[model samples]
Target: MTRNALPTLTLLSLLAILPCSGCQSSKAEIDRRAQHIAMLADDTLDELDAAVATGDVGDAALSHIASAKSNQHQIKDEADKARTALHGVEDATPWWGRTLGNLAIAGVLIALVILLWQTGIGFVIKRLCYAIGLLIPRSTKASAALDAEAIARRRACPEQRESIAARRASDPAYDAEFVRQKKRKQRDEVSRHALPKEHMEIATS
Candidate 1:
């Protein structure tokens, strides 16, 4: 994703990013880093503008150099969003208060993982993944792989896998694209493997 879009994902990635250190860290580091990058970008932009004014840099060079200002803007925006994240969910809170809340959640998850380690995390993770719809693609692919006789009982005929069908059902635009892709795949198979197409079609159909 673009740097301008990074702030929205900051909280989700925060734990893995900065040292958790009891969640004591503030937005200072994020601000400093982004500001440093923005500062350098601004300096480069100023130099490029000077070069253009002196007729040293051409239109192509100026066009590329103009991107530096946009990059600086994105960096500044990302910093602002990160600093605002502290007060995002609730009103401005004390650092210690936020730390305690994060610690509590972390402690609970850790304790449960330790207690359940004997039971093997595989089953629990699998069940949780399915429950959260993470494994829907795998489920849909398995269904599509079934033989024609077994597939006859199914109600919905899927051209693609998983949630894409639900999307195609809702969006006429996407459905059109889906149909195009299916036709293109058939054309490719026929042209690339004409001799084997007759035998291979039934297995994938």
Candidate 2:
């Protein structure tokens, strides 16, 4: 080849390789996201399965199970589409128009994937957890532990109660005694309205 033609050919070859790399990167990203979605689906499915085994699969839980399965299917379909988009033989097209076009297409595909992940995956996972009413038990346990600690601190340092005051400001359960008294008063009022005075005491007891 002529010296001038050698650099031109090299430049064209480099341009052609760009699309292949982009496609590969896009495919890898899709696979990774798909695997994450699949794992989430599996976790939710396992929860449903456990509920079913225990015969506690209520209507709400069943609905959540269906939703989780739908999410799983959608993720798998997206992964399949991504794989199919990169299915054609590499370097089959000419280096000029086709290479540039492929590069643009790869860029667009990757952008779409990112959009789906940011707006779709996180939102779907949040909705799935909410729909299942999956309130993590650990948080409640932790709060209870905190409340007990606060109570102990209050009793141990009644004269030096700065920490207890701080906790009360920060924690909802800090005013546990007041809440309990208020609830007890409300129940007493309800019982007085609903029953005779003699029966009210028995019912409350």
| Top of the candidates by TM-score | 1
Worst 10-residue lDDT window for candidate 1 reads: 144-153
Alpha carbon lDDT at 174, candidate 1? 42
Best by lDDT: 2
Report clash pairs, candidate 2: none
Candidate 2 overall lDDT versus native = 0.56
Model 2 reaches what TM-score against the true structure? 0.26
TM-score of each: 0.27, 0.26
Candidate 2 per-residue C-alpha lDDT over 147-191 given as tens digits, one digit per residue, 9 for 90 to 100: 444444344366435554566466443344323434555676677
lDDT of 1 by residue, 1-205 (tens): 3433344344444553344444443455555675676677667667766877898777777767677667766766776666567454433556766675576566555545554553578557755554444544643434333422222334335653455557657644344444544555556556767767766887789
Clashes of each: 0, 0
**What's the residue-level lDDT of 130 in candidate 1?**
46
